[model samples]
Target: MAETVAARLLARLREWGVEQVFGYPGDGINGIVAAFEEADDEPRFIQSRHEEMAAFEAVGYAKFSGRPGVCVATSGPGAIHLLNGLYDAKLDHVPVVAIVGQTARAAMGGHYQQEVDLQALFKDVASEYLAEVNVPEQLPNAVDRAFRTALARRAPTALIIPADVQELDYSAPEHVFRQVPSGPPDAPSSVVVPAEDQLARAAAVVNAGSRVAILIGQGARGAADEVMQVAETTGAGVAKALLGKDVLSDDLPYVTGSIGLLGTRASYELMRDCDTLLIVGSSFPYTQFLPDFGQARAVQIDLDGRMAGMRYPTEVNLVGDAGATLRALIPLLRPVTDRSWRGRVEESVADWWSTVERQAMVDASPVNPMRIVHELSLRIPDDAIVTADSGSSTNWYARLLRMRGGMRGSLSGTLATMGAGVPYAIGAKFACPDRPVVALVGDGAMQMNGLAELMTVTRYQDRWTDRRLVVCVFHNNDLNQVTWELRALGGAPKFEESQTLPDIDYAAAARGFGVDGVNVSSPDELGDAWDHALTADGPVLLDVRCDPEVPPIPPHATFEQVKETTEALLKGDPNAWRILVQGVKAKAQEFVPGRR
Candidate 1:
């Protein structure tokens, strides 16, 4: 039998080092499915419960491996379902390639079943590259371009392969048959070196400032050592964006944990007072946390010049790789002898940790989510890959978890979507089979999509490279974040029944899916549950009964937010006053040093 275009395309993917493609099988993709069957196990196709999970899994794989993740789906809704996860990759700036099946070429113009313009559907999300393989000969180059564009741009790229084209026999061009090699060509090396003038100006700004601060993002992942060198040389304290959590160790004296809603007081103060802000590879959206233009002169380093001054007015914009730019500037930096600035911030971070520790130790009736995360932080392997859902669980993960070297994770960076935690953990396991993978998800988010992924986990639990996967469910019986947001933002009572959830026996559900499960009610139970999950040979789900009334208070609360809290208290939400009081206490710590 002659080779099909689908076979040729799959071969290209394998040649490009793709280990797996997360997707579902459908009539639209029968040819591609056949190709998978024929290839045996070259690039394993993971069957996902939902198309969104497939995309999210791909995102998780890419985040852990730093390689473009691949996902495939049938045309129309299957391809449409990928938008949320694709947007996760787009917003987070991770690389992903999506292969979408289409109707036959003849049927595309006709109103055939499941026929929609795949390119048009993906145009906005896959801005980097979107192509339709119309002719049989276009398969090879389109596949190559899709991967290359996805990698170089660090964005999602889509290739729409029509059913007719996929089924067509593959034929090499006469010239290509004679000249082309059997293996794929090596990817071109791309090193973006900043202009000397730009680097010099950036160095000058840092040297001139009496108080310098560095904001590192995901782009600076590979430049951690260089970032530290620069931070120490300039006596600058480093604050990390959420996605950049693993770039530096939280144990570093000058390092501040995640910045923004879940930010530390030390970090907020550092940004408030710093004279020079050195932003490396992060386009942090919350400009309120950054020093104002008049407050500090900004120097930013990013490969994309467009994002240079997008967040803040820049004195120097260096378009280069974060590690490369920092490496170049290190030699020119003059070390600051007076360490008072960073020393002060370091002290603040230490005190803040003390406050956090106290909060974590609170033995309440309903388990404190903080306590669960704290224990997990203490017990998790140094190299574990942790994924948190986009709600209260993220706040806990951000505030409590300390990322060490070799440990990495991700959330819905920009989209801030829920339901990615379980898929991300599963994908992370596939990417780094030896590393322990954990998903921290709230009951709300787990109900949204995580529960379905448990079925995905059970089916492929032992088949993955690493069999150690744990899902920690914060079974609070409420959409806790939304409940708090109503009080904190709108001065409203938990307005509707929509903000709450039915109590789910997640542990029982896990057992139903053929995985190990446990329910933890108290602090002691929580600790023991962690021990069990950490040591379990297969996938385990820890259904932690967390406090629904506890609020995810921000580091700094505004007067308007205070008013809302007061209103909620008046409306008889029992937790409102306690949350308000806690916010007051945290903010008060900013003024009086060494006072809890």
Candidate 2:
């Protein structure tokens, strides 16, 4: 009796610490599935309804557990479906390993049912791309390399196992396990920025300026102290992007809150009042909040090349890793004895915050989205992990939601695609079962992919992790925000009739999958429903009807966008106002729980 090549490979994957491999089974990868079944190895295989769910589940697992998440897909479309999750992982810098089964060696270059250039299709999305050659011995190395690249680069990797090679016989190597470093990658550039003079000059501006501000982004993830040091040095107020929220403590003295479309007025006003703005790791796309002209200069630093000057022109653009760059800039910054800079920004933030309390969060409507948003934040426990779907949810939660220590979130800032929240939430929960997990999604965005994840969560609950997470759905019927955006851009708003979705009963949809589902329409029912679901032992969902027209538009969107949407909506020109249908009437959803 001889062992097949697939058995040997699956054994190696098990040794690599993959606990549960997510994917749909097929003839192309039958040998590997059988190997996974037979091998006395680490990961057990789970069949998903769709290949996208497989990759997405793995993504959730990788993000929460801080390990390499694994997924297996057959050739052609199965492999292609992995692309979106792979892209999400690559862009967001999560480690994921995808095993894609390829066509047989005999069928090389021939059109096959489940055969395509798997490597080529995946190459763009993976940090490392590999295909097993005819030689069976070469597979372990490719797999090993892919595993290494995914974790080391903090991105996704794809391995294509040719169908014929799966059955080839080979000797298994000794010690199949390898552990990659879990820390953030080394700072991109070694040559430090010699900003002694610039730092001093900037420090002087900070010292004298009436107001100073800090904009933090993804690069600041691990540099909380360093970022705080910069803010304290100049008494600059801090505002973090959706991804950078975890880095700075919410109670930090100089922190002014968040800014964006869903931004807090306090943070927005603090930024507007700042005489000098120091951007740390953030190249946020919204330029409306940036200072039009401050006697104070702007200093921006990042590891990525694209972020430099992507928005407003930078007074100083220092290209280096964020952690290292900030350390270098620290010594150059002069300490300011006077607290004027801090005082001014703080006052502005306070005044603006008062306005929000009076307006957005004050005595409000029966359909107030802010009321739902604020109330949910209060109920979510500190250790829960959350992922947000696109549209107003992304904006509202990014700016308004408050996360304490131990709570983290997943961001799709780069692609900003809809439906990612559902998959990302599911993926994160799979990775950290002990912690509660939540997926906050608008009704439209949830429909994009939430239905696919229902079975996966139901299967895993009480069986694998036993932790029941929450999927909070916002049922906002109109495409209100998108319609408005279209109107802003010289487009008509007839998209109202064409793109608006009928209100869906999300709780009913979840109930169909054997998960707990609660529908709440009013304030009182909403709180009671959330309380009941929070105590349940399995995955539960709370579907609430959030107001569709509540998302605050960015203060600075062009007049053209405003005009077009108005004409389109008023004139009944759906075609002319088509762009406005993109994200209108989005619901804001949130979850408060640790993941699997």
Candidate 3:
């Protein structure tokens, strides 16, 4: 049998050491599907419930595995469906390669079915690299470059393969003129370090500050030890961006939790008080949460020169790999003799955690949503991979949960997209099949797509060596995040038609999909439910009914924000009284005598 373009593409993927491709089936890629069958599922095709889920799963796999994830889809709508997840990857700086089938070459411009111009559709999302494989000869270079560009730029790339071209006999590019040939699939590795002068300047700035603050993002994952060494030398308080939450353990007394609107008071205070700032591998955009401009002498270390020095007015911008650059810069840094700043930061961190505990335990109607994650934080295994969807659940996940040991966590950090929690967990499971995975999701997002992804979990559970995937749904029956945003930001009451969600028994849905399902209405049941789900032989779903009135107030709520909330409540919020009560109770935790 003659090798086809589809077969050749799969072979290239195998050569690149790709273990899996997350995608859904469609007639546009009928040739590739047949080739997959013929290849005996080498570089296995992991089918997702939807194209968007496939892209998100790829993003998750890439995020956890430190490799470029690949997702495939059919023409037109399937390709379109991949945009949101691809955008998530692009915004979060995750490397992903999307291979989508396009309309048959002959039918492309005739206004035939699914004949959308994919190049235009994918232009912005895959701006790093986008190509159409018009012939078998274009296959190698196109696919290889897509992978290479994705990794090099740390962004999404795309390849559009025409349906008819996928069936053509494979042909390698000749070594003659006008033919573009590609070498074997191999990623060149190198250590990037900033120039000696730049490192010295960065060190000088760090050594000069009395109260130093260090901010880290996903880019600092590999340089944890180096970062800690720098922190100790400078007596700096460390603050993590949401994407970099797992970079440093929260147990570190000087490590302030996430820094932003959904941040810890310790982190907010850390930024507000620092005389100098060192941003490592994070382009955390909320400049308002950072030290006031011109108040602190700042230094930034980033691998991408393009992204460095854009977020803040840094005195020195060291363009290098975080681990290598920090290692080089360490020798030039002078140790701080006074430890008062470090002591203050540590004290604040401890007090913040105490306040978090008090808030999580605050009373609610049925259950406080914070307790769901707070309980999980207590029981989650040291090696668990936790994922959270975007919602009010994110607030608890950000503040309540502590990342320690080998635990890894991620979500749609930059894009802040819903419906990513379950798929990201599914991808994490595949990326590290031996590790336990947990997904914290909201009721709105669960209904949007999570309920369907459960089937995908039940289908693949046996493949995992440690099948302890738990999806905990915050069943608050409201678009809780947006509801709060409407009140706090827009100064508008929660419009029932827009904010309310239809109640669904998520646990029942899980059971129907052949997974264990537990329903918890009382706060007392959260702990036992988590224990059972965490130790289950297969995947489990905890449908936890929680209070929607519980507000996810910012750590440092401004007077204007409080005023807007009052205005919104006065303007006829449905649960105005309960909301006020919950907000007061939750916020009061910060001022409690010993807790503060």
Best by lDDT: 3
Predicted model with the maximum TM-score: 3
Q: Model 2: number of clashes? A: 39
Which model, 1 or 3, shows the larger TM-score?
A: 3
- Which pairs clash in model 3? none
TM-score comparison, 1 vs 2, better candidate: 1
lDDT by residue for model 2 (101-211), tens: 888988978886777876578768874655554566666777777787776666888888888888888654444454222322222234345356655564555555556
Model 2, stretches more than 4 Å misplaced?
A: 1-3, 127-132, 171-211, 292-296, 304-312, 315-321, 351-366, 463-466, 555-565, 572-596
**Higher-scoring candidate on lDDT, 1 or 3:** 3
Q: What is the C-alpha local distance difference test score of each model? A: 0.86, 0.69, 0.94
- Looking at model 2, residue 390 earns an lDDT score of 74
TM, every model: 0.96, 0.84, 0.99
Provide the clash count, candidate 1.
0
Prediction 3 global C-alpha lDDT: 0.94
